[model samples]
Target: MFIELDFESDIPIYMQLVHAIIEGIATRELKPGDELPPVRTLAADLGVNMLTVNKAYQHLKQLGFIQIHRKKGAVINSDEMRQADDEFYERLLTSLRPLAMESICRRLTKNQFLTLCSKIFDEIELKGGKC
Candidate 1:
């Protein structure tokens, strides 16, 4: 419900909402089994269209981040977030390939790129940040 959207961003509004929720989960701001606001209520609160919120919620559901129950609405899944599968790994590579190529094209070495990634991961502190 605290998700913020930048309408001017190149990223789609729904995806931004998805990212915010994921961040919340990762940062432990949203604990397992926590309930999210109802779609209409959240849309009203965020000043976004209902469909936008619905789309974001649907995406989260597909990723196993949240489960929709008739009585509970959208509640975070109980500490069983979907693990990255082979397809997910392939997609991850597909997404990173262009970025790697771009770095090479810009005359950055492999070590430089790896170092940058290492620094980012270190800053994120993935282990400590997990929900």
Candidate 2:
């Protein structure tokens, strides 16, 4: 798996790591049973603290994206991959509402918004993503 981090982003570094991993899974870049690099290795690779990687892994586990085994390391949880609960979807939509509203306020046409979504969906599908 490959991930690049921007320490300057307003979003937390750990959260960025978690999101990157999930996107990898969603994009089918990481498959079921794929063993992720050990936390220390990834932390070193990303030049971030070990704790950051650990926190990201913990969050991934909490979201059912990965499972950590004593000897096997972290493996993608394919069965539940991208299967966020209703509450999660609800919260996601709520979070997106502000951005959508901002786009509309900026005078983006309905077709433009639709086209953007279509492009995103196409890109995800092309990547062999399940969701």
Which candidate comes out best when scored by TM-score? 2
lDDT for position 42 in model 1: 92
Q: For residues 1-131, write the lDDT of model 2, one tens digit per residue.
A: 77988899999999999989988987989988899999999999999999999999999998888999999989998575555679899988998798789889999988898799899878887888784
Q: Report how far off residue 87 is in candidate 2 (Å).
A: 1.7
Q: Against the correct fold, how does model 1 do in TM-score?
A: 0.84
**Number of backbone-clashing residue pairs for each candidate, in the order shown:** 0, 0
Worst 10 residues of 2 by lDDT: 76-85
TM-score of predicted structure 2: 0.85
Q: What is the Å distance of residue 30 in model 1 from its true position? A: 0.8
Q: What's the lDDT for all of these models?
A: 0.88, 0.88
- RMSD values for the candidates in order, in angstroms, are 2.1, 2.0
Which regions of candidate 2 deviate over 4 angstroms? 80-84
Poorest 10 consecutive residues of model 1 by lDDT? 122-131
Q: Summarize candidate 1's per-residue lDDT along 1-131 as a digit string, tens digits.
A: 47889999999999999999988887778889899999999999999999999999999998889999999999988966667899879988998899899999999999999999998767656635564
